[model samples]
Target: MKKANVAINKDLCKKCAICVHFCPKEVFTIDQDGYPLISRLDKCTGCRLCFLRCPDFALEVETELDD
Candidate 1:
């Protein structure tokens, strides 16, 4: 399976929780600071929903093929 790296740009993020709500694999969670946390990276399917739905362009999902 391909592995995905999820990065959240804290500077750009507005704590909107859109990524947390839209992820099909439930890859994110709301942190204490109300920011989206990459909680389940292994569950990520690289579906790009979080990245595409982020209104602030704060989420980035990168997929790497496993050897």
Candidate 2:
């Protein structure tokens, strides 16, 4: 199965929680410091919902091919 590698740029992130709220698979969770955390990476569908929704352009989603 194809998987995704999600990267969050802390310097660009504004802690808007858009990615946290927009993730369909609940792959992200807001940490105590209000940063988005990839809590359920295995559940990520690579749909790019969070990446597209981030206002700060802080999120990146790259599909990983199985060998």
Query: lDDT of each prediction vs. the true structure?
Result: 0.90, 0.91
Q: Which stretch of 10 consecutive residues in model 1 shows the poorest summed lDDT?
A: 58-67
Q: Report lDDT (Cα) of residue 56, candidate 2.
A: 89
Residue 37 in model 1: shift from native, Å? 0.7
Candidate 2 Cα deviation (angstroms), residue 26: 0.2
TM-score of candidate 2 against the unseen true structure: 0.91
lDDT by residue (1-67, candidate 1, tens digit) is 8888999999999998989998899989999999998888889988888999999988888998886
TM-scores of the candidates are 0.93, 0.91
Model 2 lDDT at residue 44: 90
Which portions of model 2 miss their true places by more than 4 Å?
Answer: none
Provide the RMSD of all predictions against the true structure, rounded to 1 decimal: 0.9, 1.2
Enumerate residue pairs that collide in model 2: none
How much is 61 displaced in model 2, in angstroms?
0.4
Compose the digit string of candidate 2's lDDT tens values, residues 19-46. Answer: 8887889999999999999999999989
lDDT of 2 at 63: 95
